[model samples]
Target: MYRVIQFSTGNVGREALRMIIARPDLELVGVHAASPAKIGRDAAELCGLGEPTGITATDDLDALVALGADCVVFTAQAETRPDEALAQMCAFLRAGTDVVATSFVWLVNPRSADAWLLDPLREACEEGGSSLYVNGIDPGYSGDTLALAALSLAGSADRVVIQEVFDYADYDDGEFTGVQFGFGLPADAEPALMATPGIVASIWGGSVHLLAEAMGITLDSVSDRWETWVTPTPIDCVMTKVEANCVAAVRFAAEGFRDGRAVIVVEHVNRLTPAAAPDWAYPPEGRDGVHRVLVEGHPGIEINSHVGGGEISETFAGVVSTAARVVNAIAAVRAADPGILGVVDLPAGYAGRVMS
Candidate 1:
């Protein structure tokens, strides 16, 4: 059995924690609760599954590392606290603990990351013989895994595209939806968090390059653009409220070009509500959103899939899958040679225990 450290208590981390405990091959050694209020709580209590797992949650990096787990499932939100996340991961890696994480823009395709950004992690991995893998629904399956798998069956491929069409009404984080994405702002205004120049390319570009690299093609450049729609009148969701004429939906795409022709693309059509972007895309009836993979080749192929069919909501199901993508790979990551590992590096048929 692999000894594991679960970091954070967000939706993703909580799900991963549950997965770790359920798998007989995995043992939960320590938990890192990001929220101070949860620091002293039991692991199961932090994740809200039920009874205690006999493991208490801690926020201290030192305490977590001292437990000497074989791997650390680091699901802390890296979007806002990237520097701190990097430091923590490096600390774990240097302490000889492997890591499997949801997503890290810089490390998704480590080959594309700058020396300054990736070199430290590399050095730590080398010094301590640890490994790191980053993946999730979008950067994980929707693009690198799913899109490439679709293209592999194609006779000949001209283009590959991945899209995430989510109704942010189900996203559930008001500050994230309103402040970071500017969902309730004027159409003329830009999201300070994401609209920074080249940010989209930086975030999704790796997935594009990963597809291209697998197809034996190299991208010359990646370009991006975004558009927004207004609510026309007031609208409300669990996340935030949108006033008349405020932005209610956003559609953005980053295209990777080879020889001046677009070869790979990553796109998102996210709305505050399904009613906000009527023409963009929608989940199948009774669902909240869909991820699409389009491969234009000798025989073009399109695959559209979504989460949530049982008792849970699609958004929450997605959160579960995001955690599962990494959490399920704990065994492969633990056994693999030390250093940074990508989705492509994992062994085939990697999975976790299934409920009976």
Candidate 2:
């Protein structure tokens, strides 16, 4: 069994903890919690599992590194703290622990990553002979893998568009909804860092590059565009109130051009409430969320993924899938060559066992 340590117990991290305990091939060695209330609690209790695993949460970074576990599942939030997240992952990698993370989305394709951001992690891997992989559902399976798979069925492809459409009303992350995406701000206000110049390229650009590489197509340039929609009426959600004329929805697109035309594109339509942006593309059958991959080709193909159903909200389902993508890749990452690894570097069937 591979000894594993989880970095946090947030949305994604909690699911990681549950999967770790449920998998017979994985053993929980330690867990780290940023909140004082979570520290010293049993791992199982923290994850809401009935049984106790005797592994208590700790805030001691040194103790976690000293565990010398086989791998560390680092799912801590990196959008607001990229530097700190990088340092933490590097420290664990230098301590000889392979890492599978959902924090740094750019690492999905390290070769396309910023040199300054990726070089240190590469050095850490060399120093400790450990490997690192970064992935999540959007920039992960839905962006690169699924897009590429769909393109394979095309006889001749001209453009590829991958889109994520979701209603974030039930997503309880106030900071993310209010600050990061500018969801509750005035419609005319500047967008969050994600929609700013070069940010989307830095995050989702790797997916574009990955698809181009798989298709043997060269991109001349990449660009981004974003727009916001305002609610005409007041809307209520778990996070905050969306008063009239406030930012209610955001639509952003990042495109890779080939010979002056877009050949690869990643687009997001995120709305705070369903009523806020009723005209945006939604899932078939009135589903709340969907990830769609469209390949414009001789035999054009469109693949849609609608994950959550019943009581499961789209946000929670996304969180769980993100964690599963990282956890499922743990074994393959550990067995990979020491360095920054990408989806293309690993085998096709690295996803862990299926659960009914």
The best candidate by lDDT is 2
Error of model 2, residue 20, in angstroms: 0.6
TM accuracy, model 2: 0.96
* lDDT at 53, model 1: 92
> Candidate 1, residues 105-170: lDDT per residue as tens digits?
567777777787688899999999999988888767787777877888898888998998888786
Q: After superposition, how far is residue 350 of candidate 1 from its true place, in Å?
A: 1.3
> Clash pairs of candidate 2?
none
Candidate 2 local lDDT, 1-356, one digit each (tens): 89999999998899999999999899999999999999999999999999999999998988999999999999998867888888889999999999999988888888888887888998999999999999989888899788878988999888999999988888888776567788878777666777779888878898888888877888999888888889989888976788889988888888999888989999999888677777877667677789999999889999999777788887789989999999999989988999999898889878967454
Overall local distance difference test of candidate 2: 0.88
Best by TM-score: 2
Q: How big is the positional error of residue 59 in model 1, measured in Å on the Cα after superposition?
A: 1.5
Worst 10 residues of 2 by lDDT: 186-195
List clashing residue pairs in candidate 1: none
Models 1 onward score TM values of 0.95, 0.96
